[model samples]
Target: MAAPIDRPGARWGVAMCHGFSGSPSSVAPWAKGLAARGFDVEVPRLPGHGTDWRDLEGRRWREWTECFEEACARVAARNDVVFLAGLSMGGAIALRTASRLPVAGVAVVNPGLGFYDWRVRYIGAIRHFLRTTAPIDEPAAPEPVGDEGDYPVTPLAAVYELRQLFRATDRALPKVTAPLLAFKSDADPVVPPSSMTRILRRVASDDVEFVPLHESPHVATRDREALLIVARTAEFFERCAAKAAHPAVGA
Candidate 1:
């Protein structure tokens, strides 16, 4: 299992969360990129992730979200400005966190809020009979990059938990007021485009920006447009940090 990544020394901190069934490796590059810029960065390995899929079978969304919340609290304690970045299910966790916490900003890529396929709705009913499902697809990355460590199988129980999380996150979206930076791949196979549309429409954030990735798939962090993602993420966090430090006095 890959260990968490932490870099210290800076007034601003970023807590990055990986997607479901994905380890910290998925977002390691993005964390390092921000750390290199001198901001404290932390990439936490979610509960039951970076390990056997069976370990994820009984875990609920609350466990995953709590782990992320702990990491955010640690980062926020040390830095004047703090932000959250996540992919897929992690994005849902981040949005949920932002609704309750006073984070400076939020950045999400290929956020999996809801699925278009009707099959997922029935997972809860059939999960007791089917323990696990086959791997969805082989990890794809650019030439020099290797696959980000992900589980070989999907746990049906965990999928049900994710569905529950999506419903809760959707309900909480109207309460998230932090500046948001959302990136979506036009060809993502795992998460449908509705995920992005729903977030944009429901989130109460006044400052929101969406970037479309034409060539990447679900895991855009490790795909061809990774550098662009790093750049935009850094730029967005910097902008948020600046605003937090020097807020306007009156309307």
Candidate 2:
């Protein structure tokens, strides 16, 4: 584990998790920008990601969370202050970690709270049909970025695990202590607006803030407003750290 510093000194560390079936490259640019602004960013490649899709097929949610936890430990050991950030399923992992760990705060990009559409509601049925009937090797364009048109066909088991993670994180929201900065793209076709509203309304901490990306899609981390998201997040965490260092007088 990286040593946690009492103060950030010249740098504050951040552990960034990529979405399911996605690689660190997806969020590397965002991390780079944060690092340029004096943040020690650690973007871990999720288990079975960045490799063949089947390599990740047999893996479960624990593998993904454990990988992130290990990375967070390393960053926490080295930096006095650390923030957890993620995209999609990775956002849920960030929330889960902050809910239990002693971290500065969290920045969730398009957090997967719950599916509102019927097609998504019955995703498992489609997954089964695809899994047993026809496996799609052609990757769909990565939303928000649209750089990659190919993605590993999601494994049914892994999707199920993600569903469990979503449920578990929803249950744990009221226990989260870290301040949160959550972003959602109004045009996002993947994550529903209800999920973002629920986080804003139900999360235990009052230090939560929401940013609605006007025209962005699901992957706001890589959208046109990506840089703004990163800047705003860094600013928010910096304020949290400042408040922690020097509290306001009178309760």
Candidate 3:
């Protein structure tokens, strides 16, 4: 992944976190944009990602969280102000980190807490059917933006662990002090709108802002509104920058 931020004189550093079963390559455009805006960017490749699908068979949530925590530590060390941006599962990791770190701000895109309902339990059956008799349109699109195909079949054990992460982070939500910019899609096939609402309502900081992507699907980072995502994200971060530069004067 690129070093979190790259503007020669930029003071704040940004860490770009990718979703579960996704690699930094998928978040490249956002990282590049952040870099263009003078933020050092680091898109860390989570454990079990960017490798053969089977390599994820033995991996656990701890492996992925640790990788991001390490990246945050590295970025935090080099810059005076550090920010975070993540997609899907990466968003959860960003929240988890924000709860513990002195992060300046965070931007979350379609952060996945978990599947919506019990039917999620049937994912294995669905995967089997798709692999055997049916072929779903490759979850990652082709040509326009191809799926590198490094992710593994969803592991029940890992899913269970991710649930634990959600609960833990939910409890920590009210404690995070950083500013937040959360984005969710109206047509998302994966995440529910309620989850995004919950995050916005629970965070202790009143600096949280939510933007609904009306036309995109779950992966709004790669969806049609991607430019809007990038533009709005930069605008939000810039607002935070201005806040830091000019704190309110005493009455």
> Candidate 2 vs candidate 3: which has greater TM-score?
2
What is the lDDT for 74 in model 2? 95
lDDT of 1 by residue, 1-251 (tens): 12223334348888999999989888877777777777788888888999888898879989998999999999999988899999999899999999989999999999999876688889978898988887567346654355587787898899999999999999999999999999999988889899899999999999999999998888888878888898889888888877877788971
lDDT by residue (1-251, candidate 3, tens digit) is 32333334548778889976668877776787777766768988887777854555457777888899899988888877788899988898899889988887899998877667665466445544443221112344323354533353655444555666777778888887789999888877667777787788788877888898887777767657777887888778877866766667971
Measured on C-alpha atoms, candidate 3 has an lDDT of 0.74
- The residue-by-residue lDDT of candidate 2 on 1-251, one tens digit each, is 12233353545789998887678866765787777667789988888787777777678788888999999999988887789999877898899888878887899898887865455456566766765212323223344554532253666656666777888888888888788988888777767788888877778887888888886676666767777887887788778777766777982
TM-score, every prediction: 0.93, 0.85, 0.84
Pitting candidate 1 against candidate 3, the one with the higher TM-score is: 1
In terms of lDDT, the best-performing candidate is 1
| Poorest lDDT segment (10 consecutive residues) of candidate 2 | 132-141
Best TM-score goes to which candidate?
A: 1
After TM-score superposition, the amount by which residue 112's alpha carbon in candidate 2 deviates from its true location, in angstroms, is 0.7
